[model samples]
Target: MHLKDIIWMGGLLTVLSFPVSATEIEWPVYGGDNLHQRHSKLTQITKNNVSGLVEAWEFDTGINATFQATPVVQDGVMYVSLPFNDVVALDAASGKQLWRYEHDLDEDYPICCGPANRGVAVSNGMVFTGTIDARLIALDAKTGEKRWDNRVVGDNTGIREEVSRLDDSELGSVSGTSGAGINMAPMIYQDTVIIGITGVGYGLHLDATDSDSPLGAVVGIAGKYGRRGFMAGYDMKTGKQKWQFDTIKSKNWEGDFVTKTADGVELPRDIAKERASLEKYSDAWRYGGASAWSTPVIDPYTGILHFGTGNPSPQMEGSSRPGDNLYSSSLLALDANSGDYRWHYQQVPHDSWGYDVASPPVLFEITIKGKPIPAIGQAGKTGWFYVHDRRNGKFLYKSEAFVPQKNMFELPTSEGTIIYPGVMGGANWSPVSVDARRRLVFIAAIHWPVEYKLHQQPARNGEAAIRYSSMSPLNTPEKHGLLTAIDLDNGEIVWQVKTENPLIGGVLSTASGLVFTGEGRGELMAFDADSGEKRWSGKTEAGVNAPPITYSINGKQHIAVAVGGNRLFGFKTGQKIKVWRLP
Candidate 1:
């Protein structure tokens, strides 16, 4: 049956005073709902019996690439997106393949990162995905047939022009890198499907540091490169462009040039030089690079959608772009239908260290001063959990540092400077899960510090000389994973669990008092939600580097995660989706 028909029937039955079906415990949206909580209400697999959990079935897509997609299930049917933007449907109860749709991608499609498609969004009996080539396509949910495709961001000619203008030495294997393309999962709100691009603000990266590292430093070649990144809405039925919100603003993109963060943390900045060069680079927003990579959460009641933005262009070198670079490294709220800006909170202004707001915002109610206030919270790369008023973007409070912090906002030196919670951050692109009942938030974080160094070269002709910077991964004695639980009440850490390697994917919370997450070491485990105790663990062939999701069929709950590890982080690669249930 179609999704609209199911919703219609369910609403009708509810109005007719009939009981709702218990089998309707489905994960219909990407974060399990419009709020992006990533929490399930199923209690069939409680903490007491979770130790008996065993693999019920495993499905391999036969594509041995980095698999980061999270499966969305509805009515016992599961849908997942494979790397290179392929879509597949499966029987959630049996792991049987239903249908598959492979994308006919352009041979010359350019991407700054690996071939990873986060997942797909389903609504109105159709599934939607954004391609690496910067296009959005809709498919028949049951048959996996292409309905329509829309090029949200056009041709590579602009990207090629930007690359051609760069110096040969500055190219650094970046000629093949296109500025913008979608790596995030699409979300359907009302009748519009929303998605955004990544790699727009990415600097030229090379294997100069070490081949073992998944990603290297962003070599600074200062010039106008990378198109302005945006989050756009499309007609779900026809794949038509609806409304677009650019992360880079045109006028007044530069704020008051504050030297400190919104929370009053002092940041190091060369204010005199920046203000002196403001006019020369006033048009930098035209080529600004605040890529939107995470999925947005919508408050259905308020009709407002909230998401985060990445760093500015010519990353790690702010000489060309001055002022706060408004909107980059920010949490933005927009009107869901019209895409009009409601409010924004800039976490790091004129971010020179590549500290973008990579994690998605989670919405919930937080009580303050004996009054319940509607709030939104996001785990930041700066190692802080920021809580804000959902209605107006007001700073309510911030949690203590979830990961270690050292030499934050320090200038890159020619002699090399070490910084904790480096560019990869206290929390990377991984999403965090929240338990609203207990007012606890869970984060899978990394503690890998980075070394920042400056690079300078003479101008070739009468042109301006280039000044850039490079960030290399430091071989520190302590590089590990931190699974932290923070109580939202007083911003105190409840408990923290350290892993052998850094955590990347995300977390899932259940009503049965269990927190489920994966590690880079290929272990999928369950923890006591309140106490942060490792209750049970299971091993996969490769790293379980994607988010864990839970859904039930025939009153039986299943725990599932993707085991296609991330190659960028040097994790073992595999192509399997393993589902577990209490046996």
Candidate 2:
């Protein structure tokens, strides 16, 4: 049977087993459903009537930070997390506030990125959120009262001490140093809440001087600074630890020192030099930075969970940490119940370009040679849409470049090298939308190029010599966005639409033949899913740098999104959740 038929039968079985109200459709999961499709089946608002959409209601969160949460709805109640990890439950039909939970963060902890919480997960009358201070808390879904709070990690003073010992010049143009925290929405499977850590990858972020401009740069310094990252599951009832899977393996973390990607793309590596120095950094896995940047998507039938990992420590200068860096920059599969490793596919071996598998993976079925194969797709920062067999993590194929590509996988030089789809990505941590029946995947991508320059400083004042690299996106008029549709069957670009600013958030597609996405320029847009034609645009008070979600209440369709701008990209930040519907 086709994947669409499987999905339809699954929904039918769900409805037969548990009677659901026909008038109410809830977006219960972060990515619409367990498959992480981000595609809605609602069709009340069609292409012809989409232009008639107007603001139905709006609720201000009273927080002005990088708001990136994708709101979740269930049983006529909407749950969303603010940039500071505070969560509020709102009435789905009206904008009335039901209750709020104020997250108490530790003021002394070092935060790698600015205050940004992707969202919350609701299950079994409990609302779960990962805080900026690296703690996971569960709140009573109805009363917003805290039930339990579990600290994921201890004080990160060791990382801070290592960073402090580095020379000032070796740190490069830095706005912030690396630290540990949680940024992704928690994923619940059965009785476990799964989440991962971020900012463990040693790098320095440069903030834009102008509050309305994009980021300044991302610098990678060579040193032993960050701790290993991991994803762990916790008991739902008591918040007790269940199982943990470290992104960097404890044994043989270096692997076979392959000179190319698993899919056969050659990389620029000094294998001889790395092999000779393996013993020098044999214990690098302790500080090997493979931060988990996004949430995991599971296959219910097989009990396998798939997710992405971030870059290795010391970021772009990989001299100290050699070899393939094991699980960093790779797609990982694990047994959902036990956290046992199943398989992995590294996209960048011995990576030094900051190409992290930061986007969430989408699961579906594809027919190959008349046999239905479980497939997974991830929108990569390296300007490609990669497809793989979900069951065993086998690379199937990669789509045509969705954005411009130049000097890819090239080593940095003192004179600097220009690369497209730089650190900000062809796709960042944004979730993608998939239309299974249409065999198309929608992507919201960025088209910014960066000048990759290497810096070397000699020893001074009894300090050791240091080397690092700085990646600065060219502040040119050409930086923009691309909303692309790629054919899943053949891995081809079906259509693309360009925007004035680089896309930062995500995309949402509906069965009504409409695609929705937000822009950094304060506009939410809809397009013809088949042709990529703009159908409607609505102005917002702040940058709509978050994914748009659609659902129905009382048989009436509505669209909603978080309207706070991203601070790292320097968009206009605000504190509002806007809902719209056709009039």
Candidate 3:
């Protein structure tokens, strides 16, 4: 795909906007402009003085929780999310809180993960967030005052009553024992904001688990209205549902698709196509699991959306869904408007490793084998870095060593499946940044094998949850973390650096020619963006998972991170914001 020769955006008709300059300040949105190019054009904080950069101003966001939120900076105000569902706007230069807005927590909300927000989206003059308690809130960027709060996922009221209705089975599913909610950042499209859901596909009902709730879905929401998914678009100004594009439309796809004709919602056409595609298909919705998990990168050039899919449930038991899964554990490039499939590449087809290829796919132009290929790269939880020809989903060699495994858990079909990048994922949600000038892709990964299991314990509260969970196979060299810089041209490893903790968040590479990543132990470090050599390391006072953002405020460039002790980050922990700048 190339640049948009036709630059007409139907959604943002009124807002006069400037074209995204090739090297304008990014940190524009969560994943760095729908293309998910975490790559930045800022180079002022390069290698030479990265070490010389020290703590300038520090402000703590909160405690040991899932701080997946990366701060989004625009104008001169920096917007970020705190431990609970709190939103904070701070002076870019002072690190002093300008305003703080909090989302009420659901006493019984099931958090598959923790109380961490992935990040915020800034468009117009507002910041957007899908909060922990299942609410979609908008706050004025300048004041941190609530503009509107819409329950995006679940209602917090009477959550305790809801909890009573659940048991071991139902509770497990809600806890991400199967997959509750772990979406990255929201994508801002025109006047509408886009976000995806990840609730382990099957909706776990009160009495029992149906094993088919349709957790994975990509929805178009209104930045103005605080509306939920695509079946409806909210008015950005009024916070009202404007239109709805329910991908599944009706809930009973496993059977009948009953819909309110008046609402413009109907049975999903994709379900019908899938039903027709199946050799012995009965129902598609009852068990359609190809959830659009991560945020999709937009190809402004082709009007296409790119994203990764998660594992099909009854996940450990692959025998459940059966045929070549259309999208699970796959990389998909689809038409943004119709949700029509363009081209797809399943990293692990009929996946069994629980290796859901759900990381935000980074978009960039790479020179591969002498060809300038615009590509999409993702480091799946299965432990592999996948780089594909973004134009056609074609394969490029993976940089990891190919070891012969017993194939003890699952097998591939006659079609040759590429080897080396197992799903624990050479690099997962911890995002990677590319240095376009240097021609390198920086990635952090957990090199381990996950033991597979479908069901281990007796059903509880009528739900089946993930059993015997652990991530031991890949965290090898025992307690080591790795930062790999790949030569984009040949898909070869240029530099391999290992740390003590699993790379929890991501690496931030700047025009200053440095890469910044936080340790699982809560310390943030800087490396030569091109050489992978350590420049400096200091504790953040907490385990860090949120990606760090560097911005120039009043002529001074500073780096700041949210701190907390994440059991997953594994680093020595503390809670307090840490900041460093050039003295």
Off by over 4 Å in 1: 1-24, 156-176, 207-213, 458-466
Could you tell which candidate, 1 or 3, scores higher by TM-score? 1
Per-candidate TM-scores read 0.92, 0.94, 0.74
Scanning candidate 1 in windows of ten residues, the lowest lDDT window is 14-23
Candidate number with the higher TM-score (2 or 3): 2
For 1-583, candidate 3 gives per-residue lDDT tens digits of: 2222344477654434454353245356766555655666555676766767777777765554556677777776777776566778877777788888866776665554445567777877888777545566777877777888775544411111122222233124332222344355666656666555555442222122322221221111101111112222344555544433322213322322122111121311334444454445333323445445555678877766777766554443333243444455667776655555577776654444556666678877877456678777776665556778888888764545211133433333223233223444556667777777787877766543433222234466667542332111333455356787887666677887887665667777776677888876667888887677898887666677667777666566778776665543344445566667778
Cand. 1 Cα-lDDT: 0.84
Off by over 4 Å in 2: 1-24, 155-176, 207-214
* Per-model RMSD to reference: 4.9, 3.8, 10.7
Q: How many residue pairs clash in each candidate?
A: 1, 0, 60
Q: What is the C-alpha lDDT of each candidate?
A: 0.84, 0.86, 0.56
> Residue 324's C-alpha lDDT in candidate 3?
44
lDDT of 1 by residue, 44-147 (tens): 88789889999999999898777788899987899999887889899999999999999897667655666788889988889999887788999999899999
Query: What would the TM-score be for candidate 3 when compared with the true structure?
Result: 0.74
| Per-residue alpha-carbon lDDT of candidate 2 for residues 1-583, written as tens digits (9 for 90 to 100) | 1113223564564322332333226788899887989988788899999999989999999997778999999888999999878999999999799999998888877666668888899999999999878999999999999999998876652263244333335333454455788989999999999999988885666544532245666777767767889999999999999999999988888899998787788888889999898899887777788889898999989999999999888788788888889899999999999999999998887778889998899998889999999999999999899999998988899999999988888888888899987888889998999999899999999998889988776787777776767888888888899999999988899999999998988999998899999998899999999999999999999999998998899778999999998877768888999999987
Off by over 4 Å in 3: 1-26, 62-64, 153-182, 201-235, 238-287, 290-293, 367-371, 401-424, 453-479, 572-574
